[model samples]
Target: MKQWLRFLGPLAILAIAAFLLRDKMPFLAEGYQQVLDANNVGLVLALIVTIGSMFAMAEVMRLLLMAGGTKVSLWKTAELTFVANAWSSTFPGGAAISTVYQYQTMRKWDVSVIVSSWFIVVSGVLSTLWLVGLGIVSILFLGASFSIWPLLGSATVMLGIAVLVYLATTHPKATSRIICSEVRTFNRLMRRDPERWIPAIRKHVRQLHAVHLPRRRFALIAALSLANWMLEILGLWLCIWAVTGALPGLERVGENPSFLGVILAFVTAKIVGTAQVTPAGLGPVEAAMTASLVAVGMTASSAFGAVFVYRILAFALMTILGWIIYLISVARGGMKAGEQS
Candidate 1:
């Protein structure tokens, strides 16, 4: 049964994605047709930029692993990051699956469970923090006089990140105490003995503190994460330019969906899509992005076209590549090599 599920789960996810994307099929076709007709150079640039984001993400993972006392090659880390991200974006409960896969893969490399878990947890938090940072920057660049809501949302995001970073870094012991106590409470409610798990939790917390990243490492991770997001946004920009026949620049501000406006729209749509109610945030993301573009003065057709192109290149293409790499590596005794990574 487990084997069947493991095989069928991805197929099921793909089926669902197809079902959800049916409405956008026409737009996707049109988008591709437009690109071909225009013979746009921007599309190629966009692809390169989007692919670069994956490399940047891999670096972030490699650095985190190194901090945990394991040194993995850049290519190996990149492969794992790509596969894990693809799995997370493709399946229901993908985030959990991705975490488990990453943990197991790292364990194969002889990384301790505690370090693996820490990397997973800390990296997730850091990534989210940077995403929030991007959203906030977008809101700011779009100008506060434009919308009160996004400004407020950005402020809230900033505050949340500050609190989380503070708790995780400056107050690790206190944070651990709170988590341990909460676990004990939950265990009591479930009629399970808290003693069995409490000690383990404390030990893990101590290990996390011992391996806590220094300021320089933290800055490097933040920069890489931010660059990854920026590259993705740039890809969206190039897509819009490919369809509209005008590459909007930051200096060309003054309304009518300027470059900053497009970026703001992209950031807004991404936040909405982060809910991930659909696989890889497909339906909600497209809808949000299309709406945002139209609101910023793009024609509905152009908005849809640009968004479809960006999604195809950034999300779908990456997933396909990741799957290919995963399959090839698995056949090449990659599981054992993962440890040496």
Candidate 2:
């Protein structure tokens, strides 16, 4: 009963959200029609680039696993990527749920807990660093008068995390001792047995010492991560082109929307979407990206149309495909070797 409730909870919330936003459905439908009326070539190109973005992300995961001394194939990583993305983007608290799902799935691939944890952490850190890099680039390109303090603060936090990870990996014994001590104190406060968790913590910490990221591998992973973001941005640019071509009036608003404008809008949408107040940051991301596009001189309708098309490819289409992959994997008995594992 509890399992059923857990699965149904997010669906109920999503349905309610749809109900509350029912009035906007027609507006969104109109945007969808505009996209369909646009040049088919641009739509196809946007889809191809969006897919390439996902593939790049999967490659990053595969490389991170390799850095952790695991040899999972790209196809397997890609499968996990799509499935995990479905979990992360569609449910309440989806990001955390997706992390847990990926960890468990990797365990089935014979990945050790430590290596899997390392891959998750390192990949996340790399992604954050690159996102900040994008923000920096956008600011430079657009010369927008936005404050830089937030970006600096984010960079500082990432640096601190990187330093701590480095210390933990290089000085495993000391880190283990510190962690176990904290665990013992917490267990005592909770009237629990330290013996239950300390051994596991110590073992995992010890395994961290074996995780070494080579410079070349790290560079490649960084490049892939960057490529992933770039391709998504390119997809958005293509969507804008499609919308402008379809609606000639949009040309009056902005003759040639600069690529830098799209970058600015993409970064803004990403930052706003981190709130995750809605499933996959649905409402806030669309609002932010559309507003940003309008701020960059696009007509509101055209901006909304482009954003709608981009979301269809990036969020809706990908989510549907991911769920299909997830169901197929389950039907095949959970990603085993010789299947889509």
Candidate 3:
């Protein structure tokens, strides 16, 4: 009975929502039909490109592990990436949950705690750097007509943090001393014990010192991270194209939908969704992306339709796939290399 109730709870809410929105049923139906009628080729290409973006990220992770002197296979990393992504996008506090999940899985694969931690931190840094890089390029391509000081400020801040991280990773001893001093000062001000934290910090710093990546490998990882974002952007563009192709007499802002416009929408949606109030920013991300698309000259309905299709592919499908992989991995006794059931 409990299992049945759990399964039916969402259905009941959805049914209630449908009843409440009954008056809008026709409009919703039309949008659904339009999505169904979207260009098949474009839809297929969007799926491919979106999955490619996932693979790109997985490759970054695999490369990071290799740089840390761990030899996890590409396939295992890809599986882990999907599973981690699903966790991150599927629940409240998902990012933390996903990090813990990844760390545990990496440990199971014989990865050192320091190297595993490095992979997570550095991958995130690289991804953010490239996301800001894309935003900057989009602003330039769009003629900088809009006020962009905020974007520039954000870019500068992210770059500064990246440089600091690089320095810390390369000069662990100096970084440790500085960090310890700051911790000691804070502890003294708070009338707390500094000895307890300082030794742990030094130990972690020593572990971190062993997990350095060479410059060339770091650059390759950075490039792969950039590719991951760009491919997802392409997937969004394809979704827009597919929706527009399906909806007859849809009015676009320009001669056609602008790639620059798509980039802006993508960037804006990402920024808004960073809060992750919902799983994968489900509601907020869809709302922000739809609004951003409309601001870029798409009609509200068209924009919503495009965003719906994009999210269906990128978020919904990916989450489902990731869950399936997670279940399979569990049944197979985790993702340990060469360990058979």
Highest-TM-score candidate: 3
- For candidate 3, the lDDT comes to 0.78
True-structure RMSD, every candidate: 5.1, 4.8, 4.1
Q: In candidate 2, what are the lDDT values of residues 1-341, reduced to their tens digit? A: 45335444554665576456646765545555676687788989999999899899999988777666677778778888888887878865679989999999988887789888878887888788788888888777777777878987997898788778768877899999999999999998999987669888998998886677777877898899999999999999899888878332222334445777788889889988887766678777888998888877776667878987898788878887888898898998887522225
lDDT of 1 by residue, 258-314 (tens): 776777777778777667665577667887888888776776667877887788788
Of the candidates shown, which would achieve the greatest lDDT relative to the real structure? 2
Model 1: how far residue 290 lies from native, Å: 1.7
Which scores better on lDDT, 1 or 3? 3
- The runs of at least 3 residues in candidate 2 whose Cα sits more than 4 Å from the true structure, single-residue gaps closed, are 1-33, 181-196, 246-255, 337-341
Clashes of 2: 0
TM-scores for candidates 1 onward, in order? 0.78, 0.83, 0.85
- TM-score (C-alpha) between model 1 and the true structure: 0.78
